[model samples]
Target: MKKSLVLAMVLAGFAATSFAAEPAFLADRHVARGASCESCHGVKAPAPGAKVSSTACMNCHGSLDKVAERTKAKVPNPHYNHLIGTDCQECHKGHAQSVNLCGSCHNLDWKVP
Candidate 1:
């Protein structure tokens, strides 16, 4: 390929990649509090779309009871819901927007931030 064509292809590749890869949305929240990828994921490099277990989350966030207590004031506590033992990742997306799974079925006015 001509040099100009090769250069154009490289630049196009970079632009495509930039649009495809979103910023790690939740990284700043935990990283600012002295957490790293290894600290949370328990690996130096967690594979793309790899899930961090609830056990890993509880390590720093305490038990389910503790989480429920923290949200005690919120009526129909999310942590103490019918889906009590659900994995933390169900509603908590590390790199994407967090969701209120409870609101999926019910018309609850809760935000999962």
Candidate 2:
């Protein structure tokens, strides 16, 4: 029992340390990608016309259909709704932070009860 408890404690400590280290790894990749995120998202609020950005990124993302499949795990209507007005950074968060950044604009109207 004591041995199992100590092993669990050690694993938990490693997970905590790795979580702290994750941001640095993400930043390195963001730098290699060679663009400031703000060049796109901007201070102005997003609009439906923002679909332009999706088309631009998809040109290089290899297969838009594949990304749609993966993102649908987090967002159901990737084509018609979730990806419509938001910036790629709003949800993707590059390498550092992850989760739905769309809450910045969406928090008021969209919510789960």
In candidate 1, stretches whose alpha carbon ends up further than 4 angstroms from where it belongs are 1-24
Clashing residue pairs found in predicted model 2: none
Give candidate 2's error at residue 58 in angstroms.
3.7
Clashes of each: 0, 0
Task: List the global CA lDDT of all models.
Answer: 0.84, 0.51
Tens digits of per-residue lDDT for model 1, 24-113: 456557776779998778998999878888998899889999999999999888999779999988888787888888998999977786
For residue 113, model 1's alpha carbon misses the true position, in angstroms, by 1.4
Candidate 1: worst-modelled 10 consecutive residues by lDDT? 19-28
Pairs with backbone N, CA or C atoms under 3 Å apart (clashes), candidate 1: none
Candidate 1, residue 60: Cα displacement in angstroms equals 0.5
TM for candidate 2 is 0.41
Tens-digit lDDT track of model 2 for 49-106: 4422554455556455666565565544443464565555445544445454445566
